[model samples]
Target: MDLAGMERSSLVKYLVRQLEHFFPDGQHDLSFRIEKDLDQALARLEVCIDAVKIWRKGEFDYLHSSQYTIFLYFLSNTIWRSRQDKRLCTKLFYLNKALNGIDCFYEIEMPDIFFIGHSVGIVLAKADYANYLVLYQNSTVGKNHGIAPKLEEGVIMYPNTAIIGDCHVKARSVIAQGVSVINKDTMPNSYVFQSNSGALEFKPCSKNILGDIFRHV
Candidate 1:
Protein backbone atom coordinates (compact mmCIF):
# COMPACT_ATOMS: atom_id res chain seq x y z
CA MET A 1 0.00 0.00 0.00
CA ASP A 2 1.01 3.57 -0.57
CA LEU A 3 2.25 4.74 2.80
CA ALA A 4 2.46 8.33 1.62
CA GLY A 5 -0.14 10.15 -0.37
CA MET A 6 -0.80 13.62 -1.73
CA GLU A 7 -4.09 15.56 -1.56
CA ARG A 8 -5.05 12.93 0.99
CA SER A 9 -4.99 15.42 3.85
CA SER A 10 -1.57 16.97 4.23
CA LEU A 11 -1.51 16.62 8.00
CA VAL A 12 -2.31 12.93 7.79
CA LYS A 13 0.26 12.38 5.11
CA TYR A 14 2.87 14.05 7.24
CA LEU A 15 2.08 11.86 10.20
CA VAL A 16 2.17 8.74 8.08
CA ARG A 17 5.53 9.70 6.68
CA GLN A 18 6.87 10.22 10.14
CA LEU A 19 5.66 6.84 11.37
CA GLU A 20 6.97 5.12 8.27
CA HIS A 21 10.44 6.28 9.19
CA PHE A 22 10.60 3.55 11.86
CA PHE A 23 10.68 0.89 9.16
CA PRO A 24 13.17 0.60 6.33
CA ASP A 25 11.15 -1.63 3.93
CA GLY A 26 13.54 -4.52 3.39
CA GLN A 27 14.91 -7.60 5.11
CA HIS A 28 18.42 -6.45 4.23
CA ASP A 29 17.71 -3.17 5.96
CA LEU A 30 15.83 -4.70 8.87
CA SER A 31 16.88 -8.35 8.48
CA PHE A 32 16.57 -10.32 11.69
CA ARG A 33 14.14 -7.83 13.14
CA ILE A 34 10.87 -8.77 11.42
CA GLU A 35 9.64 -11.81 13.36
CA LYS A 36 9.17 -10.13 16.73
CA ASP A 37 7.81 -7.01 15.18
CA LEU A 38 5.32 -9.12 13.28
CA ASP A 39 4.29 -10.83 16.51
CA GLN A 40 3.76 -7.50 18.25
CA ALA A 41 1.84 -6.07 15.36
CA LEU A 42 -0.36 -9.17 15.16
CA ALA A 43 -1.02 -9.00 18.89
CA ARG A 44 -2.15 -5.41 18.50
CA LEU A 45 -4.39 -6.30 15.60
CA GLU A 46 -6.15 -8.93 17.70
CA VAL A 47 -7.10 -6.42 20.35
CA CYS A 48 -8.18 -3.97 17.72
CA ILE A 49 -10.56 -6.52 16.26
CA ASP A 50 -12.07 -7.04 19.70
CA ALA A 51 -12.47 -3.32 20.10
CA VAL A 52 -14.26 -3.12 16.78
CA LYS A 53 -16.61 -5.91 17.79
CA ILE A 54 -17.51 -4.04 20.96
CA TRP A 55 -17.81 -0.74 19.17
CA ARG A 56 -20.11 -2.28 16.61
CA LYS A 57 -22.46 -3.55 19.29
CA GLY A 58 -22.67 -0.23 21.10
CA GLU A 59 -25.59 2.17 21.48
CA PHE A 60 -24.25 4.75 19.07
CA ASP A 61 -23.82 3.77 15.44
CA TYR A 62 -20.16 2.84 15.48
CA LEU A 63 -20.15 2.39 11.70
CA HIS A 64 -20.60 6.13 11.18
CA SER A 65 -17.92 6.87 13.69
CA SER A 66 -14.73 7.97 11.93
CA GLN A 67 -12.87 6.45 14.83
CA TYR A 68 -14.12 3.06 13.79
CA THR A 69 -12.87 3.31 10.22
CA ILE A 70 -9.51 4.63 11.28
CA PHE A 71 -9.29 1.74 13.67
CA LEU A 72 -9.89 -0.87 10.96
CA TYR A 73 -7.41 0.78 8.67
CA PHE A 74 -4.82 0.95 11.42
CA LEU A 75 -5.33 -2.65 12.40
CA SER A 76 -5.29 -3.88 8.81
CA ASN A 77 -1.50 -3.86 8.96
CA THR A 78 -1.04 -6.93 11.11
CA ILE A 79 -1.04 -9.36 8.21
CA TRP A 80 2.09 -7.78 6.81
CA ARG A 81 4.56 -8.09 9.72
CA SER A 82 6.72 -10.55 7.81
CA ARG A 83 10.33 -9.42 7.52
CA GLN A 84 11.00 -7.53 4.33
CA ASP A 85 7.37 -8.16 3.67
CA LYS A 86 6.58 -4.83 2.07
CA ARG A 87 2.92 -5.68 1.62
CA LEU A 88 1.54 -5.44 5.14
CA CYS A 89 4.28 -3.34 6.66
CA THR A 90 3.67 -0.57 4.20
CA LYS A 91 -0.06 -0.78 4.70
CA LEU A 92 0.37 -0.71 8.46
CA PHE A 93 2.38 2.46 8.21
CA TYR A 94 -0.30 4.05 6.12
CA LEU A 95 -3.17 3.07 8.41
CA ASN A 96 -1.19 4.14 11.47
CA LYS A 97 -0.92 7.71 10.23
CA ALA A 98 -4.61 8.03 9.47
CA LEU A 99 -5.59 6.51 12.81
CA ASN A 100 -3.27 8.94 14.53
CA GLY A 101 -5.00 11.93 12.94
CA ILE A 102 -8.39 10.61 14.02
CA ASP A 103 -7.07 10.24 17.53
CA CYS A 104 -5.62 13.73 17.50
CA PHE A 105 -8.62 15.51 16.04
CA TYR A 106 -11.48 13.25 17.12
CA GLU A 107 -10.44 12.48 20.70
CA ILE A 108 -11.30 8.86 20.12
CA GLU A 109 -9.37 6.77 22.58
CA MET A 110 -9.01 3.24 21.25
CA PRO A 111 -10.27 0.61 23.67
CA ASP A 112 -7.98 -1.94 25.31
CA ILE A 113 -9.46 -5.30 24.40
CA PHE A 114 -6.93 -8.09 24.54
CA PHE A 115 -7.19 -11.82 23.69
CA ILE A 116 -5.27 -12.98 26.76
CA GLY A 117 -3.67 -16.28 25.63
CA HIS A 118 -5.29 -16.62 22.27
CA SER A 119 -6.33 -13.42 24.00
CA VAL A 120 -6.14 -15.11 27.39
CA GLY A 121 -3.96 -15.18 30.48
CA ILE A 122 -2.97 -11.60 29.66
CA VAL A 123 -2.85 -8.81 32.21
CA LEU A 124 -3.78 -5.24 31.30
CA ALA A 125 -5.57 -2.21 32.74
CA LYS A 126 -8.74 -0.46 31.67
CA ALA A 127 -6.87 2.67 30.76
CA ASP A 128 -7.07 3.56 27.09
CA TYR A 129 -4.57 1.43 25.19
CA ALA A 130 -3.73 3.03 21.90
CA ASN A 131 -4.12 1.06 18.66
CA TYR A 132 -1.87 -1.96 18.00
CA LEU A 133 -0.36 -2.93 21.35
CA VAL A 134 -0.83 -6.66 21.94
CA LEU A 135 -0.24 -8.72 25.07
CA TYR A 136 0.18 -12.45 25.19
CA GLN A 137 -1.58 -14.56 27.83
CA ASN A 138 -0.03 -14.41 31.33
CA SER A 139 1.36 -10.99 30.57
CA THR A 140 0.32 -8.15 32.87
CA VAL A 141 0.33 -4.36 32.63
CA GLY A 142 -2.21 -3.44 35.23
CA LYS A 143 -2.44 -0.06 36.90
CA ASN A 144 0.03 0.69 39.63
CA HIS A 145 -1.61 3.34 41.78
CA GLY A 146 -3.90 3.87 38.82
CA ILE A 147 -1.03 4.52 36.43
CA ALA A 148 -0.48 2.17 33.47
CA PRO A 149 1.81 2.26 30.51
CA LYS A 150 0.52 3.63 27.26
CA LEU A 151 2.04 1.45 24.54
CA GLU A 152 2.99 2.88 21.19
CA GLU A 153 3.37 1.16 17.83
CA GLY A 154 4.27 -2.52 17.38
CA VAL A 155 4.51 -3.43 21.05
CA ILE A 156 3.97 -7.18 21.56
CA MET A 157 3.86 -8.26 25.20
CA TYR A 158 4.79 -11.91 25.63
CA PRO A 159 3.12 -14.23 28.12
CA ASN A 160 3.95 -14.61 31.82
CA THR A 161 3.40 -10.87 32.49
CA ALA A 162 5.95 -8.04 32.51
CA ILE A 163 4.85 -4.39 32.56
CA ILE A 164 4.30 -1.71 35.17
CA GLY A 165 5.06 1.94 35.78
CA ASP A 166 3.90 5.36 34.67
CA CYS A 167 6.00 5.04 31.56
CA HIS A 168 5.48 4.93 27.86
CA VAL A 169 6.21 1.45 26.48
CA LYS A 170 8.07 2.90 23.58
CA ALA A 171 7.29 1.41 20.17
CA ARG A 172 8.47 -2.13 19.41
CA SER A 173 9.53 -3.73 22.66
CA VAL A 174 8.73 -7.32 23.58
CA ILE A 175 8.08 -7.60 27.29
CA ALA A 176 8.71 -11.29 27.90
CA GLN A 177 5.69 -12.09 30.02
CA GLY A 178 6.22 -12.78 33.72
CA VAL A 179 8.71 -9.91 33.94
CA SER A 180 8.35 -7.11 36.46
CA VAL A 181 9.00 -3.49 35.74
CA ILE A 182 8.72 -0.70 38.29
CA ASN A 183 10.46 2.65 38.27
CA LYS A 184 12.43 1.36 35.30
CA ASP A 185 12.89 2.46 31.69
CA THR A 186 12.23 0.14 28.68
CA MET A 187 13.66 1.23 25.39
CA PRO A 188 12.23 0.12 22.04
CA ASN A 189 13.21 -3.33 20.72
CA SER A 190 14.52 -4.49 24.05
CA TYR A 191 13.09 -7.38 26.11
CA VAL A 192 11.94 -7.45 29.74
CA PHE A 193 10.30 -9.87 32.18
CA GLN A 194 9.86 -10.43 35.88
CA SER A 195 12.22 -12.65 37.84
CA ASN A 196 11.40 -16.35 38.28
CA SER A 197 9.29 -15.76 41.36
CA GLY A 198 7.50 -12.92 39.67
CA ALA A 199 6.58 -15.01 36.63
CA LEU A 200 5.36 -17.92 38.74
CA GLU A 201 3.30 -15.76 41.05
CA PHE A 202 1.48 -14.21 38.13
CA LYS A 203 -1.81 -15.82 37.22
CA PRO A 204 -3.06 -16.48 33.72
CA CYS A 205 -5.38 -14.01 31.98
CA SER A 206 -8.33 -16.41 32.17
CA LYS A 207 -7.77 -16.88 35.88
CA ASN A 208 -7.99 -13.14 36.36
CA ILE A 209 -11.06 -12.76 34.14
CA LEU A 210 -13.22 -15.74 35.10
CA GLY A 211 -15.97 -13.66 36.70
CA ASP A 212 -15.00 -10.08 36.08
CA ILE A 213 -16.00 -7.25 33.75
CA PHE A 214 -12.85 -8.09 31.84
CA ARG A 215 -14.07 -11.58 31.05
CA HIS A 216 -17.48 -10.35 30.01
CA VAL A 217 -15.96 -7.77 27.76
Candidate 2:
Protein backbone atom coordinates (compact mmCIF):
# COMPACT_ATOMS: atom_id res chain seq x y z
CA MET A 1 0.00 0.00 0.00
CA ASP A 2 1.15 3.52 -0.83
CA LEU A 3 1.69 5.97 1.97
CA ALA A 4 -0.61 8.58 0.46
CA GLY A 5 -3.50 6.23 1.24
CA MET A 6 -2.91 7.04 4.88
CA GLU A 7 -4.65 9.66 7.03
CA ARG A 8 -4.79 13.14 5.56
CA SER A 9 -3.59 14.75 8.78
CA SER A 10 -0.27 12.92 8.54
CA LEU A 11 0.56 13.79 4.94
CA VAL A 12 3.42 16.17 5.68
CA LYS A 13 4.85 13.79 8.20
CA TYR A 14 4.64 11.04 5.66
CA LEU A 15 6.49 13.05 3.05
CA VAL A 16 9.12 14.07 5.54
CA ARG A 17 9.58 10.46 6.51
CA GLN A 18 10.37 9.46 2.97
CA LEU A 19 12.52 12.53 2.51
CA GLU A 20 14.56 11.40 5.46
CA HIS A 21 16.02 8.70 3.26
CA PHE A 22 17.74 11.46 1.28
CA PHE A 23 18.20 14.10 3.96
CA PRO A 24 18.97 12.28 7.15
CA ASP A 25 19.90 13.11 10.77
CA GLY A 26 17.19 15.63 11.63
CA GLN A 27 17.85 17.56 8.43
CA HIS A 28 14.31 17.01 7.23
CA ASP A 29 12.98 19.81 9.34
CA LEU A 30 9.73 21.61 8.56
CA SER A 31 11.28 25.02 8.23
CA PHE A 32 9.70 27.81 6.25
CA ARG A 33 12.10 27.34 3.36
CA ILE A 34 11.76 23.55 3.39
CA GLU A 35 7.98 23.83 3.62
CA LYS A 36 8.08 26.18 0.65
CA ASP A 37 10.16 23.64 -1.26
CA LEU A 38 7.76 20.86 -0.30
CA ASP A 39 4.83 22.92 -1.48
CA GLN A 40 6.41 23.40 -4.89
CA ALA A 41 7.41 19.72 -5.08
CA LEU A 42 3.90 18.59 -4.16
CA ALA A 43 2.40 20.86 -6.79
CA ARG A 44 4.53 19.23 -9.49
CA LEU A 45 3.82 15.82 -7.99
CA GLU A 46 0.11 16.41 -8.59
CA VAL A 47 0.71 16.95 -12.27
CA CYS A 48 2.85 13.78 -12.56
CA ILE A 49 0.38 11.68 -10.60
CA ASP A 50 -2.42 12.94 -12.80
CA ALA A 51 -0.44 12.00 -15.88
CA VAL A 52 0.21 8.45 -14.58
CA LYS A 53 -3.27 8.23 -13.04
CA ILE A 54 -1.79 7.51 -9.63
CA TRP A 55 -4.43 9.67 -7.98
CA ARG A 56 -7.42 7.89 -9.51
CA LYS A 57 -7.81 5.82 -6.36
CA GLY A 58 -7.04 8.79 -4.10
CA GLU A 59 -3.63 7.32 -3.25
CA PHE A 60 -0.17 8.75 -4.02
CA ASP A 61 2.23 6.45 -2.23
CA TYR A 62 3.65 5.08 -5.45
CA LEU A 63 4.82 8.59 -6.27
CA HIS A 64 5.76 9.96 -2.88
CA SER A 65 7.46 6.79 -1.72
CA SER A 66 9.56 6.41 -4.84
CA GLN A 67 13.02 7.94 -4.50
CA TYR A 68 13.69 8.21 -8.20
CA THR A 69 10.21 9.40 -9.17
CA ILE A 70 9.82 11.97 -6.42
CA PHE A 71 13.41 13.15 -6.78
CA LEU A 72 13.10 13.72 -10.49
CA TYR A 73 9.72 15.35 -9.96
CA PHE A 74 11.22 17.80 -7.52
CA LEU A 75 14.30 18.35 -9.66
CA SER A 76 12.22 19.17 -12.70
CA ASN A 77 10.06 21.55 -10.71
CA THR A 78 13.10 23.27 -9.27
CA ILE A 79 14.67 23.64 -12.68
CA TRP A 80 11.42 25.05 -14.07
CA ARG A 81 11.25 27.62 -11.32
CA SER A 82 15.00 28.22 -11.12
CA ARG A 83 14.82 31.54 -12.87
CA GLN A 84 13.06 33.07 -9.92
CA ASP A 85 15.95 32.48 -7.52
CA LYS A 86 19.50 32.09 -8.74
CA ARG A 87 20.78 30.81 -5.41
CA LEU A 88 18.11 28.16 -5.14
CA CYS A 89 18.72 27.08 -8.70
CA THR A 90 22.41 26.55 -7.98
CA LYS A 91 21.53 24.59 -4.89
CA LEU A 92 19.04 22.39 -6.69
CA PHE A 93 21.42 21.84 -9.58
CA TYR A 94 23.92 20.15 -7.33
CA LEU A 95 21.24 18.30 -5.36
CA ASN A 96 19.94 16.65 -8.51
CA LYS A 97 23.40 15.55 -9.63
CA ALA A 98 24.41 14.29 -6.21
CA LEU A 99 21.18 12.50 -5.43
CA ASN A 100 20.00 11.06 -8.73
CA GLY A 101 23.08 11.30 -10.98
CA ILE A 102 20.75 12.89 -13.50
CA ASP A 103 22.41 15.88 -15.09
CA CYS A 104 19.92 18.45 -16.31
CA PHE A 105 21.74 21.67 -16.97
CA TYR A 106 19.51 24.59 -16.17
CA GLU A 107 19.47 25.66 -19.81
CA ILE A 108 17.86 22.44 -21.02
CA GLU A 109 14.08 22.47 -21.43
CA MET A 110 12.41 19.89 -19.24
CA PRO A 111 8.71 19.26 -19.47
CA ASP A 112 6.89 19.86 -16.24
CA ILE A 113 4.51 16.97 -16.91
CA PHE A 114 6.30 13.68 -17.39
CA PHE A 115 7.03 10.31 -15.74
CA ILE A 116 10.50 8.78 -15.28
CA GLY A 117 11.30 5.13 -14.71
CA HIS A 118 14.27 3.77 -12.80
CA SER A 119 17.86 4.20 -14.08
CA VAL A 120 16.68 6.64 -16.75
CA GLY A 121 19.31 8.71 -18.58
CA ILE A 122 17.95 11.97 -19.99
CA VAL A 123 20.45 14.18 -21.80
CA LEU A 124 17.60 16.17 -23.41
CA ALA A 125 20.13 18.84 -24.26
CA LYS A 126 17.92 20.57 -26.79
CA ALA A 127 14.93 18.23 -26.89
CA ASP A 128 11.43 19.40 -26.10
CA TYR A 129 8.89 16.94 -24.73
CA ALA A 130 5.09 16.91 -24.82
CA ASN A 131 2.77 15.74 -22.11
CA TYR A 132 2.10 12.07 -21.21
CA LEU A 133 5.62 10.93 -22.15
CA VAL A 134 6.79 7.79 -20.36
CA LEU A 135 10.54 7.03 -20.00
CA TYR A 136 11.57 3.59 -18.82
CA GLN A 137 14.78 2.21 -17.31
CA ASN A 138 18.17 2.64 -19.02
CA SER A 139 16.54 4.69 -21.75
CA THR A 140 17.98 7.88 -23.25
CA VAL A 141 16.13 10.80 -24.81
CA GLY A 142 18.76 13.12 -26.16
CA LYS A 143 20.56 14.55 -29.16
CA ASN A 144 23.48 13.57 -31.39
CA HIS A 145 24.57 16.92 -32.73
CA GLY A 146 23.68 20.27 -31.24
CA ILE A 147 20.11 19.83 -32.45
CA ALA A 148 17.73 17.71 -30.41
CA PRO A 149 14.44 16.15 -31.43
CA LYS A 150 10.92 16.93 -30.28
CA LEU A 151 8.65 14.29 -28.81
CA GLU A 152 4.89 14.53 -29.19
CA GLU A 153 2.37 13.60 -26.56
CA GLY A 154 1.50 10.01 -25.50
CA VAL A 155 4.91 8.61 -26.41
CA ILE A 156 6.00 5.54 -24.42
CA MET A 157 9.68 4.55 -24.58
CA TYR A 158 10.33 1.09 -23.24
CA PRO A 159 13.49 0.06 -21.36
CA ASN A 160 16.81 0.67 -23.15
CA THR A 161 15.21 2.66 -25.95
CA ALA A 162 17.18 5.60 -27.29
CA ILE A 163 15.48 8.44 -29.13
CA ILE A 164 18.04 10.89 -30.35
CA GLY A 165 18.97 13.60 -32.82
CA ASP A 166 16.47 15.87 -34.57
CA CYS A 167 13.73 13.24 -34.79
CA HIS A 168 10.04 13.63 -34.28
CA VAL A 169 8.46 10.84 -32.32
CA LYS A 170 4.81 11.36 -33.11
CA ALA A 171 1.99 11.13 -30.64
CA ARG A 172 1.08 7.69 -29.25
CA SER A 173 4.23 6.07 -30.64
CA VAL A 174 5.93 3.26 -28.79
CA ILE A 175 9.72 2.90 -28.89
CA ALA A 176 10.44 -0.71 -28.08
CA GLN A 177 13.19 -2.03 -25.86
CA GLY A 178 16.78 -1.57 -27.12
CA VAL A 179 15.49 0.22 -30.20
CA SER A 180 17.53 3.19 -31.33
CA VAL A 181 15.74 5.87 -33.34
CA ILE A 182 18.33 8.38 -34.38
CA ASN A 183 17.54 11.21 -36.80
CA LYS A 184 14.19 9.76 -37.88
CA ASP A 185 10.56 10.74 -37.76
CA THR A 186 8.05 8.24 -36.45
CA MET A 187 4.42 7.99 -37.48
CA PRO A 188 1.67 8.54 -35.00
CA ASN A 189 0.44 5.25 -33.45
CA SER A 190 3.53 3.51 -34.73
CA TYR A 191 5.71 0.97 -33.00
CA VAL A 192 9.48 1.04 -33.47
CA PHE A 193 10.96 -2.29 -32.52
CA GLN A 194 14.18 -4.22 -32.98
CA SER A 195 14.53 -7.15 -35.38
CA ASN A 196 16.45 -10.33 -34.61
CA SER A 197 19.30 -9.06 -36.77
CA GLY A 198 19.48 -5.92 -34.57
CA ALA A 199 17.89 -3.71 -37.20
CA LEU A 200 15.15 -1.20 -36.41
CA GLU A 201 11.68 -1.86 -37.78
CA PHE A 202 8.57 0.28 -37.78
CA LYS A 203 5.00 -0.97 -37.76
CA PRO A 204 1.57 0.17 -36.69
CA CYS A 205 0.95 -0.23 -32.99
CA SER A 206 -1.78 -2.86 -32.59
CA LYS A 207 -2.15 -2.78 -28.81
CA ASN A 208 -2.76 -0.05 -26.28
CA ILE A 209 0.52 1.83 -25.91
CA LEU A 210 -0.01 3.90 -22.79
CA GLY A 211 -2.85 1.86 -21.30
CA ASP A 212 -0.80 -0.48 -19.10
CA ILE A 213 1.36 2.29 -17.71
CA PHE A 214 -1.37 4.76 -17.00
CA ARG A 215 -4.05 2.14 -16.43
CA HIS A 216 -5.50 3.67 -13.26
CA VAL A 217 -5.38 7.17 -14.67
Candidate closest to the true structure, highest lDDT: 2
**For each predicted model, how many residue pairs clash, with residues at least 3 apart or on different chains?**
20, 1
| Model 1 regions lying over 4 Å from their true place | 1-117, 193-217
Superpose all Cα atoms of candidate 2 onto the true structure and report the RMSD in Å to 1 decimal.
Answer: 4.7
Candidate 2 lDDT, 1-217, residue by residue in tens = 1345555336655444545555565643433334455545656666666656444432466344233445444644564564344434444455555655555565555565666665345444557878777876677777777778889988888887888897988998899887988888888988888778766678997887577666432
Q: In the order shown, what is each candidate's alpha-carbon RMSD? A: 14.6, 4.7
In the range 1-217, model 1's lDDT, one tens digit per residue, is: 1112233134333434544565545324232333335334434444444343333332222233333333333333333323345554555444444443211111223344532233334334544465345555456665678776677654566666556767676655556644666645567655554565543122222222212312243
